[model samples]
Target: MMNLDAVEQAGEQIWQTRKKMNYTTLGLTVAYTVQMLRDGEIYIPEYQGHIVWSDKKRMRLIESVLLGLPISEFFAVKIDEEKWELLDGVQRLTTLDAFLNNDIQLKNLERLSKCNGFRFSDFSALEQGKFESRGTRVVLLLENLRLETRLDLFMGINGLDKQATL
Candidate 1:
């Protein structure tokens, strides 16, 4: 059992450590996000999970976008002025990228049934534009942070212990 004073001291220490971490939140448009991915601006860490979302799940995500539902914010760590390491939301980001790049065809979209068989190209120009302009929220842990801390945070955020080497 922990002493009351010791517990309070530990809590204060945790709060102070968290205060030292820097981060920011912003809304990035789909077009900008796709461009970043295409241009290789964001880095996916090796320990990140592989894309395993089923076609139905992917379709539902797209359907949510089309229906204006809020998506969970992506978490990344800034590597420098021009690069970032993605920590979370890889599945969502990649799925959106694949869909916009015409690599994914919508199927089993319950809410957007008419778009079930459609690809990005099949959408009307206005609809396509709207989709491209959609904003996804992202949380970025700023640069200058230690790699170990970043990895620890990633593990904490994802609840994984893959023994990442870097």
Candidate 2:
């Protein structure tokens, strides 16, 4: 049988440990984020799942950014001093990655319908500048966080979204 005093002490220790974890919020430009993805500095875990956004959905998100609308924030954990593991915003990041790499073309955009069928390479210089200038907010769990804490945080955040799973 478990000792009651020992269990209470263990629980207190866990609570104190968790209180010490630190996090930081940053606003990163689309250009910088895409560059990091290309360089493989951002880790996309398998649990975040595949890129499932349709062309229309992807296009809409891009249009929102160009229109300076607020997009959802991303959650990531620092893997090291130089690398980050993305916990949320997989779909958003993957869509941007694909679009920037010209692997996917924008289509059926509502606000920017004329941009349909155009790859990032086909964008005018001004359009490219606008796209790159847009920024997204990121909440980073510092490296001091335990792996299990990070995983729990990821699950808790994603579980509330109907589109995400373990």
Candidate 3:
């Protein structure tokens, strides 16, 4: 038979433990986030699954940024004061990385179809500036958070029924 008292004790312990976790939020620019990705300040773990977003989806994300729309927040865990492990938004960041490096070409954009074939390099200075200047919100899970908690949070966020495409 199940031990009801022990189960309640365990639940209480979990609630008490989670009460001590810390987090912070920051609004950072797309250019800054991309720069961090390129510089290795922010990265995905090898175990974090592959990038599955299609090219058209990627273009739509970039289009949202360029058009000043609010993209979803990125969630990351602090590895140190200077480094972060991306828990959410891997696909979005990977798309940005691939596009910025000219590895992927933008295509099939609905409203911005005129620039469909363009890579990051193809954008004019003004267009590039607009793209880079847009802000993306980030939520940082502080270093004090335990690995199990971080993993649970990551899994919970990713396991949602309606996955965030942005």
- Candidate 3 at residue 116, lDDT? 83
Compared with the true structure, what per-residue lDDT tens digits does model 3 show for residues 51-78?
Answer: 4887668888888876789889999989
Taking the tens digit of each residue's C-alpha lDDT, what string does model 1 give over 7-54?
Answer: 999999999998987899989997788778778888777767553788
Measured against the true structure, the TM-scores of the candidates, in listed sequence, are 0.90, 0.80, 0.82
Worst 10 residues of 2 by lDDT: 157-166
C-alpha lDDT of residue 138 in model 3: 90
On the 0 to 100 scale, the lDDT of residue 117 in model 3 is 84
In candidate 1, how many clashes are counted? 0
Pick the TM-score winner: 1
What clash pairs does model 1 have? none
- Candidate with more favorable, higher TM-score: 2 or 3: 3
The per-model lDDT (C-alpha) reads 0.84, 0.80, 0.81
Report the Cα lDDT for candidate 3. Answer: 0.81
Tens digit of lDDT per residue, candidate 2, span 1-166? Answer: 7799999999999999777767889999888887887788887877666547776678788779767887799888888888999988888988887877888877777787887788889988998888887888899888746666766777788664434553
